[model samples]
Target: MYGRILKVYPGSLAEELELVPGDKLLEINGTRLRDIIDVSFAFADEEIEMLVEHEDGQQEVYEFDKDYDEELGVE
Candidate 1:
């Protein structure tokens, strides 16, 4: 399962990674994301590997080693 990025906040990690509103979140740390609830558990990791699909059908991978408490700033 995958979750589409409906919104990316300004100055957010997603925005910093150049993610757009239409980006689809395919995976996190190699695990498929099935629902919103999974986000809390998955994002708790200080290191994250996110696979994103853009509206133009382009795919990009992002690696994050941020503070565990840092917000993703997305919905």
Candidate 2:
């Protein structure tokens, strides 16, 4: 499963994750992602892995390890 990002907050923690508007979310951890709710629950873990598609057609994988309940300020 996958979801496309429609918008992003400027200067938010999402920027630090290198997420941009229009990026295609491919996966979370090793599981397929479907929507925002899926993303929300998936990120509840202390560690996460994400596959993203860039506007220029580049695909990237990012991993994050943080405290539980920490918000990335993304939307």
Please tell me which predicted candidate would have the highest lDDT against the true structure. Answer: 1
Would you list the C-alpha lDDT of every candidate in the order shown?
0.84, 0.79
Candidate 2 Cα misplacement greater than 4 A, ranges: none
* lDDT for each residue of candidate 2 in 1-75, tens digit (9 for 90 to 100): 677877667776578887877888888787788777888888788887888888899999999897788765655
* Residue pairs with clashing backbones, model 2: none
TM-score of each: 0.90, 0.81
Q: Output candidate 1 Cα RMSD.
A: 1.1
Candidate 2, residue 69: the lDDT equals 80
- State candidate 1's TM-score: 0.90
> Mind giving the per-residue lDDT tens digits that candidate 1 earns over 1-75?
788878889999878887877789888888888898787778889999988888898888999798989878777
